[model samples]
Target: MTIHRAHIAGAALASALSMTSSANAQALEYQNTSGGSVTVYGQLNFGYLNFDDGESTTDEIVDNDNSPSRVGMALVQPFGDNQLRFRFETALGLRSSSGISQTEVPDGIDWDRTNIRHFDFAWANPNYGTISLGQGSMATDGVTGADDSGTDVISNVSVSDIAGSFAFRDSTGALTGVELSDAFSTFDGGRRGRIRWDSPEVANFTFSVAHGTEILDEDADTDYTDLAVRYGNDFGDFNVNAALGARRIQPSGSDDEDYVIGSVAVHHAPTGLSFAVAAGSEDGGGDYYYAKLGYARDFFAVGTTAFSIDYYEGDDINGAGTSSDSVGFSVVQSLDSANSEIFATYREYSYSDGTATSYQDANATMIGARWKF
Candidate 1:
């Protein structure tokens, strides 16, 4: 077996253009690069950005020229019998902190030591099974994350306007500045760990199920658990996947927050990608959802290099009665493995009420080259 120390999802990087590669779920891939015990590759991003809050009074240059460059490095190590038999991946990166107040945390330009971005390990074999440990995505989900929202895609706010986008909340009047607590948002960083199993493929179809555990309570000795089932397959021309996920945040808690999320996607060869989305109410609060339409294609050479473009849309969150809808776009290309490429992004956030403009409206535009290895 073999092992490597590198996290997946490099697609989250701001600007690097290439057909996304699949993480080796069954083997080690770093050995394909230099043919040694370890392999390394990363993105060194330099961006030139202009952010405007609809009014010129709030325009600011965000990155690249004078902005602190973002850098990351990852190493992969593989060992054991089956190659996929044993492996470890870890990544270290530098991040600039930003929040409601720049002074809430530190002054500016700092590297975090106590914070961990990525740390996880997995073991699997066709004959046996697979188990993962540490902080990672829930076993019941796919890559429906914000990064894969494609390009220029909006937030889930607008989707709230859909037929069933609103939920039960006491948010009648426009409330700004006074943010919603973790109860309203899905990003509460609670305790999370996952376990799952996959049945070998029959034809092009595979069946999978996963269960996740979260320490929702320490004082009461209770935790959250989520269960999910998925069906996936690929035809000659396209690949299709669907999943049903449900989370029981805390069975013993008073709120008993439980929600369900279902996703389906069909990606055709060199271009089209389509996805269906549905989110159910937690503890029978209500329901909301969204659908996405997108396509990707490569283009002509400009000044001796190739360029590409990607576009997507659709966002809904907070239901139709509350605020939280946004649409955004980003275009990135490589200037060279060690250089940069041009980039520009835009997003129009709309809300059920006038509060949408304050919480989501903004457009970002930029042009410059980036560098990395």
Candidate 2:
């Protein structure tokens, strides 16, 4: 909901005058106001997952393998023709398999944690651009794997939210006792406490930059910097968008790493077809690649239906000579009336050391739903 500052000011004056006049019957709602409206919004997502690592199989309910559930509030206040915006959003781990109290949930995790997603203030002008400060997304948050494929909800480059729980096993189905390598991640950048600025789009192009002390605590804390550029435009029935990003991470007690990431996506509105590809390489002989193809159209009376296939591979992570590969397919159907989606997905994963011998192989299938407001 949005309310003008002028109207709120007038209401406050009227309310003050009404209070002074004891006989007055009418009362204004805004007795004290700073002039802005806050809108609350959120999403709830969960999936029933059946996972198999050859050795064993498990079925359970998980949250946000497709997208993390979150709730947030946004405040918009106009200052003359321009405006100031404030946002506070947090992820909600609705179901905890660990059985820990909410207060005890650890911070900085994307799943199964009440992590603060954004707490930032921004000043924006239609012609000038936007500047943001405080805890928020860095310039390249999702730039590396920007995709227009409608099936990104269930098939994309990122790892599943519950990936941490998937353990690697030997061919005999015996627990190789080795946890999956962290190299599986695609390093698409993420939210951080930082200062960022985005240049107003010109000719369908925008540029951004940011610097922060610590973006994610997953690894050793680092001083980080990122720069990115994005382009979007339409040519006839074909829509095209792409991004290029670079990040430098100076780890506190480890070797510094620099990465260059690029992504391009195209969508055809008439045929409801889409395709995207993303790849990144780090300075220390580490790299990743991802690709997705999808098609979507209104197949049912309710809403649009989408299907897609995606593949990802990472090699020589941080000089550890570990590699990972994944391939998946998904179907998603939107329910416009309920602001929700019904989805099902299947994926296969494989891991290997520097040697060609397979260390682990796993597969999973999931059926899920997501609601947004």
lDDT (Cα atoms) of all candidates against the true structure: 0.38, 0.72
Residue 265 local lDDT, model 2: 96
| Residue runs of model 2 more than 4 Å from their true location after superposition | 1-36, 95-114, 177-181, 215-220, 318-320
Q: List model 2 lDDT by residue over 157-181, tens digit each.
A: 7744444446677666566544443
Error of 1 at 112 (Å): 3.8
The best candidate by lDDT is 2
Clashing pairs in 2: none
* Model 1 lDDT per residue over 251-361, tens place: 454666666666666667545444444344445454444454545445534322222232222222343445443344445543333344555544343434334343434
Each model's total of backbone clashes: 42, 0
After aligning candidate 2 to the native by TM-score, how far in Å is the CA of 212 from where it should be? 0.9
Name the regions of candidate 1 deviating beyond 4 angstroms. 1-37, 45-51, 54-109, 113-115, 141-175, 178-199, 202-224, 229-232, 251-254, 270-281, 302-320, 334-342, 352-373
Error of 2 at 34 (Å): 9.9
